[model samples]
Structure formats: C-alpha cells, structure tokens
Target: MSTSSTGVLVLLGAPLGNPEDASPRVASELVRADVIAAEDTRRLQRLLRELGVSTSAAITSYFEGNESGRTEPLIEQLYDGKRVAVITDGGMPSVSDPGYRLVRAAIDAGFTVTAAPGASAVTTALALSGLPCDRFCFEGFAPRKDGERRRLFASLAEERRTMVFFESPRRVADVLRAMAAAFGGERSAALCRELTKTHEEIRRGGLGELAAGAESDPPRGEITLVVEGWGGPDPEDATPEALAAAVARLEAAGTDRKAAMKEVASRFGVPRREVYDSLIDRD
Candidate 1:
C-alpha cells in the first residue's frame, strides 16, 4: 500500500467492456488503495482476475442505491488517513456512476483527490462516431420515464454541440424513437454498441433511420449514442431571459444550478458570465 499522510480519494476508471483497455496505472492503484469503493463488487473481482492483480484493501459496495448513505463513512475513512479508491463497473466514477458525493465530500473535507485515467465510452464513441468532437456534451443516461425523457430531449433540442448518451440494451430503441420525435428523424447520429469488445458495432444514420433499424433489430449490448448538433439558427441568441429560462429547464430536470447554467451557456454559445447575468436579470 502507498504511504498515506492526509489520505487521498482516487477515482479510478475501470474498463468500459474490455479490461485489457485499462491503463497500466490501474493495477498499481489497485495495489495502493487502502479501501476500494466498488460500484459492483463482483464486477471488480472479475476485473482483478482479468488484470492479474490482488489487493488486501477492504471492498465496499457503492452503487446508486446506497451512494448518498455511503458517503459519510467513506469521508470518515478519509479522515482516518485511508487511501480510498473508487472504481465503477465501467468508465469513470461519477459520470453517470457513483462517486460524485464522495469526491465532493472529500474536497469539502480538505482531502486530496485524484484519478487513474482509463478508456471512456464517451470519448471512444465520440471519436469513432464521425461527429463534431470539437464541442460535445455527455448527457449521461436518458430518463426512463417517457414524460421526463421527452422533456429532457425537448430541453436539449436547441443544443448545438454534439451530444452523447448512454442507454441500456432494452431501452436503446425506445430512446432512439423518442429522439426521433423530439430531435426529428432527419438528425444525423451514430449508435455505438459493445464498444471496445468483440462484436463491437457503430451504426451511423439519421435519428429516424436509426430508430427504424433499432426497432427492427434491437441492439444487445451496452450502447453509447453520438448525435449531431442542431443545424438551425442558434436557439437562444444568448438573450438574458432565454438563457435564464434554459438554465431553469435543466435545473427543473435535477441538474445543479451552476452546472445547468454552464450547460446553457455551452448550448447557446455564450459566455458563462452572460448566463449568470441572465439569472440576475430574472430576479
């Protein structure tokens, strides 16, 4: 185990699908950690077996079900000068995974925080999707409920940057259909399935075409979707009221106020300061 002073919170990114894609540093971090916060303990075990590594670190379950409740004890571990490592089943923790609360808590508690970088479905798909990677946003997983999902889709309708989304095999077609309705069928997009593994596939087409194809032949793997941005005129024109309104929509959908404002700014192609000013004008 690595020497510990004030302790550290290591947010380790496990492989998305192929464990071999994991960085060399992952094995070393696995060894150095005093406590490992695994999103799926069984999955972590499989990963360890794949990597030919072993650790005596205490393993703890830290998935969505108990993320909030589990934060405090993890913080206490940090207080005790423990090298806490968080490894999700795939990708980086906190990007549509459990680890944000612990990270924020560690920062608030004045403990050092770091990450062992690894392959990400988000970037990997974006790179291979033939979409505009210069500006893009990860939308995480779309809402399961159609109403909320449609609302989210509508809220992002004006988003001009390339967009990426994660979806389950069961819901991939459903979300594609919803996107067809909200973003229109003609919107260009790519469906990247089983990325970085055997049987990996990247199907590119318009939203409508993809929706039809997915319905006819449902995808059967972890899916990451990359979509082209709006081709029409800028939605907000960076107006103060409109900027505030856009941020409000995202906040109403459970996004933090600051993050909502930042997203609004990115979508509208305006300075973040303008989004903040818009909020002030709203009051």
Candidate 2:
C-alpha cells in the first residue's frame, strides 16, 4: 500500500461521475504520494474537496496536451525513488486518457507501476447495455468525420463480439446513423448518456430509432454506445433473399438505396451488381 519505499508509480482510477465511487486506497494514494500527475488539476482538486482529503503532494497537469512533455520529468521523480501517482478526471488512467506514456517510461526505467482500481464507465455501461457481454470489445471513440465514421463501422460490419464505443454528444446521431447504414437498422444497440450522474439515460432500441431520438433531442454529457455484433452466420453464407432484405431494411431506415446496396454488397461478400440485381428484381 505504501508507495514511498521505491520507484513506484500508482495509477488511480477516479470515479466516473460520483465522488463516492472512489476507493479508500485511491484516497490514501492521493494524499500520501510525493508527486501527483493529474489530467485536469482543477477536477482533481474538486475530487479531493469532495472526498475531504488533503494532500501535500506536488500536483502537475498531465493531459493530452502535455502528457508527453511531462512523462520525462515524472519518470525522473520515479527514478529518484519518489512516489508518483497518476490520476485522470474520470475512469482509469491511460484508459482513453493520458497515462500510457508515463507508465511505459517508468517501466522502461525499472520503476514499479501499480493501480488503485475503482469504478469504470466502460464496464458500467457494458453491464447496463443489456447486450451480450460474454465476449465484447471496447472501441475507445468513434471517428469525428462522417466519412471516417462510416468507414470505421463498415470495417467492423462482420465483428461478432459485442462492441462498445465512447462518443461525443455532438456526434451521437451521426454515429448511430452510420451504424445503421453499415450494420442494418434492425441491429440492436443501447445509448448510455451521463452514466452514474443525476440525469443518466439509457435508451435501448434499434440503431435507426436511437439515431432519430438523438437527432430530435441531442443528449448532453458523456456518451457510451453499446452495439450488438453480428451474432448470426457469416454474411457470405446468407441467401440472396437475405442480402436483399438487409438492403431493404437499411433503405427503410433512411439510408440511400444505392448506398444501402453497396453496404450490403460489402458486408455479404457479394458483388455490387448482384446486390443491385436482387433488389431490382424484388422491386
């Protein structure tokens, strides 16, 4: 539990939204460490105030903008055998945040690294998603640009394991729309917003419905989206009728007819002409 004995770096997982979620060991490290590297010093200060814990540790800002520059100096402190604790504003350090570089540097310099585990939004959202959690993958954040986002979802169209993603409130609708286009409108998904917070909302439905809901009332606060993966047989194994049906479903969900055909073609491992022909014949 003591960090001052050697070149030890403690990575503490702060509460996602609730201050009470912080563990007792994390509070101890926050107060007793020689140096504290925080993603947002103001937020860290707020957390300390909420916990009513005081620390004599030297606090330094270590975020995306300065994490690289701060890594060397923090590593030096660790090399000097000073206890250094890394903490993010929410969730675990280095988890879609700024602790990877410092942790890697400390390990390279033979400093021991440890963690004070606490609440995680990823697992929390996953459990609340009500999707199959037996096998799942966390996609840190979806791309911002529409093209990039569509391509990303297109690439994962065949993924069988449940997929989790962190998205901004601004792009929630766009992400959902792209997901519907690539994975079909009937694909199950859950949108978890402001998790563990006062206004937490979990909207469960097909991608199309969720996208429309987000468009109508853009959600605020942190957003985590959980999507059901391709649990059935491979797309290539699907019948011609099935491929046509997929395209029709996407088109019905607001996807362009041609775009839906293209996505279905790519997903089903069939030629674009074949998909188009099937849809045309059915029509």
Candidate 3:
C-alpha cells in the first residue's frame, strides 16, 4: 500500500528485554512510518537507540490512561493518509496493552491493520513452562479482590486446556493460594518471572507449594503463571454427604460448624449452602 494512503495501522512489537530481539521488519516499519503512537516515548527512543534505527516520525503518547482520548487523533492521522505505527513499551501492542481501542477504531473506519510480530511473554513463558502447549488460554490477570478472585478461579475449575496468567509480584502469593483452593492443592504449575532478563527465575511445583514459596519470599519482576489442566476428580474421594459428615466431625472437634462447612464447600467445589443443606439432610 502507498505510504500516503488513508486507513493503515502498523502494529510493531517492542523488545521484551534483549534489544536484539526486535524484529528487522519492526525496525523498518518504525523508520518508515509517518506517525508513531508509542506507549512510552522515552522507551521508544531508547529502543531506537539500542537498535541503531533512526525515526523522525511525529511521536505521540498512547497508553492505558489516555488511549480513548488519543484514538481520535490517531485515526485522524490514519484518515489523512499517514501511516501510523503503534508500539508498546515492550511486547506487541494490544495483547495486554492499550492499542486495541485505536486498532478497533481504525478497523471500523475501514483501515488496513497489520502487525510485525515479535517477542511475547505469554508464548515465551508457555514455551518455557514445560506445560502442555497444544491448546491453552491466556487469562491476562485475575481479579484483585479475594471474593472476586475466588469466583473467577472457581469458574475455570473444569477448563481442559492449559491456562496461562499474568500476575503482579505483590499479589502472586494470594493468587496462587486462590488457584490452589479452586484448582486443587496438588495441581501442577509453573511460575515464570522476568522472562528474557538476567534475573529470570522459573518455579515449578504444585499450586499450594508455589504459594508457600511465594510466602517465604515474594517474587520480583514480571510473572507468567502456567497451570496444568484439571486431572479429573479422585473417584474415591468423599461424596457430598460424606463431606458434610466430615465437616460435622470437624465441628465436634471444636471447629466452628459454619467455617468447617465453608472449607468443605471450597474443597469439594460446591456452594457453602449446599454443604450446609447436605449436613441438615443427613441429620
């Protein structure tokens, strides 16, 4: 397509960590674009410096906070026959960044959108995770609230494909705890931190074990968690009724009945009320 043609978006992938990881096509597009929409202009400049590529394109900020307001100006530039290239601080734009809105706007405006794919933590971690990769789902980040996080993990308890998630260091332990409770304490998983960086670390173990490890020392840097799919429930495990009886036993052992029922409900993947009703039905 001609450089001056309206409605064209060039999505370029920024370097994940190693500057050499930037693709040749991405460099070419960055140099040739008429307008560059970058998540961080300083980071973009640094990337260009690292790659030895010079760009004189009019650069504008496009990030999470202002993406909505900036989409119009970007679309206007595209409509005015300027080739607009969008890049995030690292990784491909819009995968977990703020470029989706502008891309969608451009598409609705009949623009041609294309990408120069490069490094991604999602696939990078998945490949390094030692988990099944044939089929997988990327859940970027779980809800922060405990109740919401629990519900979110609970809904995915039966997912068959390997699951990947992005989590911050601060909440990694809590997230692991919730995953352990929802997916089973023994579910195998990999926690990949700081992929492609010098201090990169990968911890592989059961969810409960990982949670305990995180408790000892919270992880640092970006993290990608890869969890194995459900292994099917144990056939010989206690039934719901039997589980209620066990809860009663725990209560008789001095545990609060309500709390015991809640724990049983979580372990058995049922509602607390259901476990309570089971206990009543047994009585």
* Candidate RMSDs in order: 7.4, 5.6, 6.3
Q: Which candidate has the highest lDDT of all?
A: 1
The C-alpha TM-scores of every prediction are 0.81, 0.84, 0.84
Candidate 1's C-alpha runs over 4 A off are 233-283
Error of 3 at 72 (Å): 0.5
- Cα error, candidate 1, residue 128 (Å): 0.9
Query: In every candidate, how many clashes are there?
Result: 0, 0, 0
- Pairs of colliding residues, candidate 1: none
Report the lDDT tens digits of candidate 1 across residue range 1-283: 7566688999998898898988889988998899999999999999999999999999999999999999999999888889999999899998988999999999999999999998799999999999999999999999999989988897787688999999998998899999987777999999999988899999999999999999899998889999999864365466887788777767766789989988878777888998999999898
What is the RMSD of candidate 1? 7.4
Candidate that beats the other on TM-score, 2 or 3, i.e. the better one:
3
Sort by lDDT, best first: what order? 1, 2, 3
Which residue pairs collide, candidate 3?
none
Worst 10 residues of 2 by lDDT: 246-255
* lDDT for each residue of candidate 2 in 196-230, tens digit (9 for 90 to 100): 88898999999999999999989999999999999
Q: What Cα-based lDDT does every candidate model obtain?
A: 0.90, 0.87, 0.86
